[model samples]
Every structure is written in structure tokens, then in C-alpha cells.
Target: MYDQATIGARLRMLRKWRKLSLVELADLAGMSKSYLSMAERGERALDRRSYIAALADALQVSETELVGGPHLTKDPVQAAPHATIPQIRTALIANTLTAPLADQARPLPELLADMDRLDHSKYKFREAGRLLPAIIDELHVHAADPADEAEHRLALECLIEAFQMATFTTKDLGYGDLAHIAAMRAGEAAAILGDPINRGKADSLRIHTMPATTWRVRLTAAEQAVERLQPHVKDDTGVHVLGMLTLAASMAATVAADASRARHWLDHAAELAGRTADAPGDNWGAFSTTNVNVWRISLAVEQGEGGGVLELARNVEERRLAERRGRHTAFLTDVGRGLARDPRARERAVEWLHRAENVAPHKFRNDAKARETVGVLLQQVRSTTAGRVLRGMAARMGLPH
Candidate 1:
């Protein structure tokens, strides 16, 4: 029943009741002026859990109380004609964003439920992306506190995952800039919680945002993050090491872009994954040997090594088919693009690209290199209907026009 207009009205009421200007509220809440303005106007939505908590804290009320009903019902405190922090937070978290509360015993179930809800919801990717920054800001407010550190950390991780989903699900979304900012913020928050796994995840995202042409910048960020995390790497028997190894391998892959370098990194990553597997623990973030293989396949495709790509692609396909969750849409996109460039494999490459698109269009939409590969295939099938469809898709995705 909660609508954007109602949410905006409540936010304004709360600010006025507290006698705080928008600038003051934004400063106290650690958000930008523009975001605050949009929230007050109900032009923006909140999506991050931490942000909701922070808004609740700033308004000095429980999130449940703010959204469900105002406190002190006996006297029937007049519904303050203003926005309460908690109300704003609740409205945003419940309506705009998709981050779930970290249920200590039911985190995965909670996340799955939320994901289902998102799938069924009316919100589209463009709207969701627009709401992310404010959600991140709200999450920041809660994450800054030393108390409730574990809950705060989990919320941050959830936010990071949500951001990833937003970035990966929307075609031609133009969210790379926002993704970088959110990843950096998440990294800072993860660092505060002393959770190396989250920290490494954030680092990986940060590296991903770097342009491939700017290898030096990416290398420096990766190396620095790894060095900073050196102390945490001693214990390699948990999900933490898997994240670290993935971050390292991803960075090394960016550096050399060669099969040998990639193989070395994957070997190390596999070793760490194996050690973690030997320990009695459920894998966090789905870290496993198969993940290492995916990374290896991606690298081989990147390096343009035909035999390696074919072998690795076959392995990935077989494993992914066996494990429904391990499907690497990004890796398949790479393979398709690679084959699309070669005359012999052009048909096969188009098939791969088609499959990749079906799986996740957003991931491959903005990739210029992939578009170039598809372009080659287009030339071979100039008069075919498939070529026209491919060309149209490429244009829409901002690939070579």
C-alpha cells in the first residue's frame, strides 16, 4: 500500500519535526544533497538495507515502528506530517531495493525469497539502478557503527550482491560508473568488519570496473588489496581464501592475459579451494574448484588459444550442466565472441553468442570486443535473418554501429 508520494510526504514531515534541513540531514546521514532531495520528493527509491537502518537510527525510531505504525498509540500522537528516517528507510528497503535482512539461521532462504519477489515485482532494471546510490548511502549510515558489526557487515554484503545483480541483469544499463562507486564503498565497509571474504569480493568488483586498456591501474589496485590482506591469508581453510585467490587470479589475468600466467593463478586458486573443501564447512559465495575452472576457461578464451578454449569450454559445459548453478554466462559470451571471429567456427560462435544472450544479455551488451566478434559473423551471413537480428542487437547494446 505504501507509495512513493506517501513515502516522500513522510520523509519531509520527519525532517521538519526534527528541525533539520535537508543538507543537515544528508550530512548526518552521510549522503549527497541530490539523493536526499530525490528521497524527499519521492522521485527516488531506497534499496539498500544498511541505508534503511541508518535512516531509522537518524530518526530515532525502530524501522518496524516507523513503517508499520508510529509509537505511543495510547495518546495517539498525531501522525507527524513529516518524513521519519525509519519510514524512509522502510519504504526504500521494502519497496525500492532488494537487499534482505541477514537472518543468521536463514540467510540463503531469505535471499532466495527476496530474489523471487524481485522477479515478480513491477520494478525494472533502469529504475532499480537509479535507486541504488541512495540505498548504498543508507547502508553506509548503519555500517559506520561499531555496534551490531556482524549484522552491518552482512547487510553490506547483501547490498554488494544486489548491486552486482543490477549491473549484470540490465542490458545497455550504463551502470559501470555506479558499480565502481558501490564496490569501493562496499570494500571500505568490509574492511571495517574484519571479514576478508567480503573484502576480497569488494576488491574483485573494484578490479572489474577498471578498463582493460588501463591495466596498470587495475594491477595496482589488485596488488594493493592483496598486500593489505596478507595477514588474513595465513588461514586458508575457509571461503575467505577462495575469495582472495579469485581476486588475485582475476588481477593476474588482467596483467599478463596469457595462458601460462592464468594457469599459474588458477593452480594456486585451485589449491586454496581444495584446502577449504577438506575443512568441514559450507562454501560461502559458492567457492569451489569449478569456479577455478570457469576462471581458467575465461582466460583461455581471452588469450585466443583454440585448443585450450575448446577443451576448457567443453569441461565448463559438462560441469555446468551437472550443476545448474555453475553456469558461467560471461565465460560463454567470451567463447562465442572468440569463435565468431574465426571463419571455421563462425556458425558455432554465433550459436554460443545466442546462448549467452539468452542467459544474460546485460553482461555482454557493452562489451565492444564481443560486438566486434559478432560483427565478423554478421559479415558471413549478410543476407540471413539471423545476421539482421544480431546486427540490431549489437547496435542497441552500443556495440559497433
Candidate 2:
């Protein structure tokens, strides 16, 4: 019985359940038979978006089914975020601009202030999930019935911010349906608000929230978004938003295996990042030199370029990323996952993952890639400390150790 709870295990089970030979599945997924065998045996990591998407398509399953998401933890603290998804979904689906679910609404400024606080939390998924539903309900009330045009604009801005946060919260917890709805809500609000930068922000969120299975379509949309935002890139916020969109395009390119296009998009983003300050904690997307490097490391990992990842990490401004919990943890997590593929670097991988967990345990524990990396490293455990750390992470994630 394959009960290891890893993607490779799931792949093997699904393949056998469908009565397909290893070579058959590989042929369906457009991969070599030997590569598919290695992936099924857990000798290779299925960490790339393209591979997972391809396998899921071949298996006639959703990507989430293959990835085994909406993970639940035995720890009450870690499971708290998952509990909030239901309310968020209800709030998003059941409420309309003219009709809100909540009875009383708070002032616009107060709600906006709350949104700002949540933004500065730096991807504390639990906190955002816990507080966003009520704020979203209230913000919709204000947007539905405002005093004046100025008040309505403020309400739309806050609503867009809240929707973006909701998208992040739900997306991380594997609630893809709610995430898509939240992103659409943001884009609608941005259109009404008629702010080009906010529209660009909403567009970037849409790109990120788009399903990886549609990499070709997403790549085209990202390219169009970058062009749309080009003339509006007259300020730092515009630059940040545009840079994020460019990065999104690069990610899609990477998933599609268009290395040349991905590098071109990344280089353009790097140039844009240089024009702005490294504001990792900004309400806008954290588009800075450090953030660019973080994306570079993650993209390199997706492409299975372990050596290139570290070389790219050399340019990450550690001091700037110190208190930016989201970007900091992301950088560490990708680096750890990137290095986990190398037998000699297993211990270093554990150390990097541990640092990331310390910075943001909630975010780190919920990360699907981080969980897969831990599972893969656990299978090859050697060093006592590394094994211990991997086991601890597995326990926290409610996975068998």
C-alpha cells in the first residue's frame, strides 16, 4: 500500500488504479519512460508546475487531486486557517455589492486601516483568513452604499485590497474556487475605481491566481497585462505592479519551458526593480531587487537548475528581506527545496527550511512545495539533525514520519 502521502506516491497509486503501465503514463504525459519511473519511485521530485499539470491532465484529474491539497494538520493552531475557508467562501459567494451578509458596517477608514495591518503581516495566512471574511462583508456594504464619489473610490480601493488578501489566503489553503472568485472581485472593483495601478495590481493577482494547467493562456494574458501597464508606469507603485506582472509572465514562460522568453521577462523585471526601493512590506506587490532574486530562485527550482538557484540567490539583499516575513520565508523555502535535490546538501536544506519556519511557521507549514520537499528529504535522511528536523516538519504537517 502506498501510504507515504507524497506526490510521487499519489502518482504511482493513480497510475496503478487506472491500469496503466509506467511507459503508458509517461507517453501520455509526454515524458521519457525512465524519467517517469524515477518520478514514480521518488528518485526525482515532481515540483515543477508543468510536470504536475501534465500528469494531472493525462490522468484526467485536477491538479489539486494530484498534489493532495487542502492539507489538514493535527495541531489546532496549524489547522485554524483551514477552518476559516468556509466562511470566506460564503462571504464571497453569498454577498453582492447591493446586498451584504453582515448587518452593521464599519467606517471606510477603519476598514482600510485593518486591510493595511493585514498587508503588513507579510502572508500570515491564519491572521488574514481569520479577519478577512468580516472585513470583506463590511467593505462590500460601504461600496454598495457610499456617501460620495470620493468615499466610493476609497471603498473600492479597500475592497480591492481585501479581495486580494482573500485570494492569497484561500489560494494558499487550496481553495482554488474561492481564490478565483476573490481575484475576479478585485478586478471588477479595480475597473470601477478606474485606477490604472490598481488595475495592474488586480491583473497581477489574476495571473498569480490562474491555474498552472493553463500556462500557455496565462503566458499570453501576462504578456498583454505588461503591455497594458506600460504607459502607466510613471511612478514607483506602477513600477512595482508592472514588475510583478513581468515576473508572472516569466513564471508562465518557465512552466512552458521557454527559457529564452522567461529570461527576457526576468531581465526586464530586474531592470524595473532597480528603479524602486526594496519595499517588501508594501501594500502593493513587493517588487524589489530582493523580491526579484526570490522569484529567480523559485523559477530556477521549477526548472530543476539547482546550481543556478544558489548563484541567483547571491544577489538577494538579506538586510532588506530581514523583516519582510513573506519574501524572507519564500526565499529560504525555495533555496531549501532547490538544494534538497543534492545528496551532499541535505543538511543545508534542513537548516534553510528551519530558518524559514522560524520566520513564518504558519506560511511555511501550509506551503505545498515545502511539504513535498520535506517528504523527499525524509526518504533520504542521514544526518541526525536533518532527519529530526524533517520529521518535526512532517509531524507538524500531519504527515506520516
Candidate 3:
């Protein structure tokens, strides 16, 4: 189970342990003393990566040390995902393209079919956890020793995707180290396959799975990814990959608080989205007009532009985000978190957060930001019913209410 203490509680303990006064720590972190106090008192939300990174640097600790995670919950549905993380870690460590650990693997066709079904695992965390380790092992077998050149290339493709799935599953479950391993393995397979499109996709995974720190470094990496992939973007798949890269750049710039750079990348992504429309069924990060708007809302929230977030949310054609359950839930949670930052919209924040949890219980319940939003809403619970709902959500997240 996760530590019941909130992030603020952890920060307080860490600060006192380091023997740093509030003002001293604030100065070190480049924030006002009062603002740091509010965060320590749980009166401010620590949902922004920038906040976490700054404090981590100031305190001489990893960001994960501040924002506790890999929260092993008691709920069976939620716990299932964490259960498989160990096996995924083992598979990532023990296997490689040259000498796979799995003694036997299924035929290439069977492995491909499994990959198709596991696509839904993007939202179905439990299902992904249950299947990913074995699939990764089997795919590695095929990748290591294919029946033909054609099958060799296809097997490598499947292997890269399996690693991508592993990347997301571990990262989502808060196993950051394991997620990085998976991403590196994916990049390895992409290189062997020698497909520029697949290579870009693997690059995206690596960038996205990076530890939530060093925004400027991440931004530079994203820009480099765009430059490397731009020449190969001749089809919808390439465009989707390139577009997602821009979205990644936009997000990194937002966290760095470079407003002009952020908007420039966002507008560039919007242009690419226009070309591809909505590739809902595409496994290439689901790049679309709707997804770009989703990122827009999220960036606005990160910028603390609550009003702009709502305006953008209202304009989103969410229906067009079909089958992209993760993006849809992200949209809802972003709105909820954004609104929770505003004292005037606490009630609405609760409603949107509830909707988000309803849409993807496991995803929403495990999300640090969603939990942070719930904590924020709980602070000013005005209605009896809203209080009851928020408490239930808190209980599921194992938060002290």
C-alpha cells in the first residue's frame, strides 16, 4: 500500500530532516516562502512537474522521493497491475534480441494477434499487466530467431510495441526505473528494425518515459526528435508520430514556463493534426485534432490558466476522440485539476473528477494528479453529497481524509 501521508506531509518531514527553515528551503527552490509553506501544509496542489522538479533539486532528492508512488492499493482491480510489474521488470532485465530468456515463443502470427488485442490495455491496465510479460518474452523469441526475413521485420515491430506497452504499464504504475528499461529496449528493437517511423515512435516513448525532471533538457530532446522525424513524415503514420513529438515539445515547454515556445510547438502540432484529422485507431500515440486539444487543455492547466483550460475544454470535440480512452480520461482529469486550482470552481472540479474516475477507475484512481485534485477538492467540500463522493474517492486512493 502507498504511504497514507500526503505529498505535503512527506515534504515537511524531508525539510525538517534536512534542518532547513521554510524560507531557506524556498530560497533554494526559487519559490516564495509562503508558497512553499502552502505546499507543505497541503493547501497548494503539487500537481505540476515543474514544482516537483524544483523542490527535488533544492532538497537533493529524486522527484519520486517527494511524490511517493508505485502505490500498491488493496482494490483487486487496481492491485492487479502492480502485481505484474515485477514480472515485467524481470522480463526486461533477462531478455534481449540476441539471447532471449524465454525458452519457447509462439509463432509470429499468434504474437501479432495478441498485440492487436492488447492494444486496449492502454486503458485496461490489469489486462495489460496480465499479458505483457509473456507477450514480451514470446516476441523476443521471434525477434531473435525468425523463420524468414519478412517475419524477422514483423517480429521486430511486434517486439517494439510490446516494449512500448511495457513502458507505459510500468510508468503508469510508478515504476520509473523499470519503465526506462522498457523504453531503452524498445529503442533497441527499433534500431534493429531500421524503420525510421518505428524509430521515431520508440524515441517518443523514451522522451515521454523520462523521469519528471529537467524540463529544459527534455524540451531540447523533443525538438531534436521533431527534426530527426520531419524528413521521414510522408504518410499519416509519420505525421502522427511527428505530431505527437510536437505535443511532447509543447508539454515540456509549458513545464519550463516558456510560454512562447510552448505555444509555437502547440500551433505546429495543431497544423499536423489538421493533416491527419483523428487517427483514433492508429496505434501511433493516437495523434489527432482532438488529442492536440487534449494536450492544449492539459498545458493550460499546467500553466495555471484555469479560465483558458475551461474555454478550451468546452470547444473540444470529445466525441471525435473515439476509442482513445486514456486521452478522454486525461481530458476530464485535466479539467478537474485545472478547476480545482480555482477557488470559485471547486464544485465543478469534483463533478469532472468523478466523471474521470467513472470513465477509467483504475487509471484515474492511480493518477497522482487525480488524487491531488481529490485532495484539493476535499479541502473545501461545501455540499454534503460532494463531501461523500470525495471521501469515497479518497478512500479508494488510500488517502487520509
Best by TM-score: 3
Select the stronger candidate by TM-score from 1 and 3.
3
What TM-score does each of the candidates earn?
A: 0.56, 0.95, 0.96
Instruction: Order the candidates by lDDT, highest first.
Output: 2, 3, 1
User: Residue-wise lDDT of candidate 1 within 1-401, one digit each (tens)?
Assistant: 12112233466777788888888878876777787686565444332223444565676654432332222111111112111324323323343222323212234336545644443333323234444434444444443431464666665666665554443332122234444554565555556656765677677666766533445456566666655565666554335544544545564554444445555556666776676652211344445665566666656555544433666776553433222221345567667755654557666666777776655454344333354455444446554656766766555443343
Alpha carbon deviation, residue 101, candidate 3 (Å): 1.7
Estimate every model's Cα lDDT from 0 to 1.
Answer: 0.49, 0.83, 0.82
lDDT of 1 at 79: 16
Better of 1 and 2 by lDDT: 2
Q: Model 3 segments beyond 4 Å from truth? A: 121-123
| Candidate 3 lDDT, 289-399, residue by residue in tens | 878888888888888766446888977787766566767788999998888888888878888888888877877877877877687667777789878989988888878
The weakest ten consecutive residues by lDDT in model 3 span 120-129
Best-to-worst ranking by TM-score: 3, 2, 1
After TM-score superposition, what is the CA distance of residue 40 in candidate 1 from its true location, in Å?
49
Against the true structure, candidate 2 reaches a TM-score of 0.95
Ten consecutive residues with minimal summed lDDT in candidate 2? 1-10
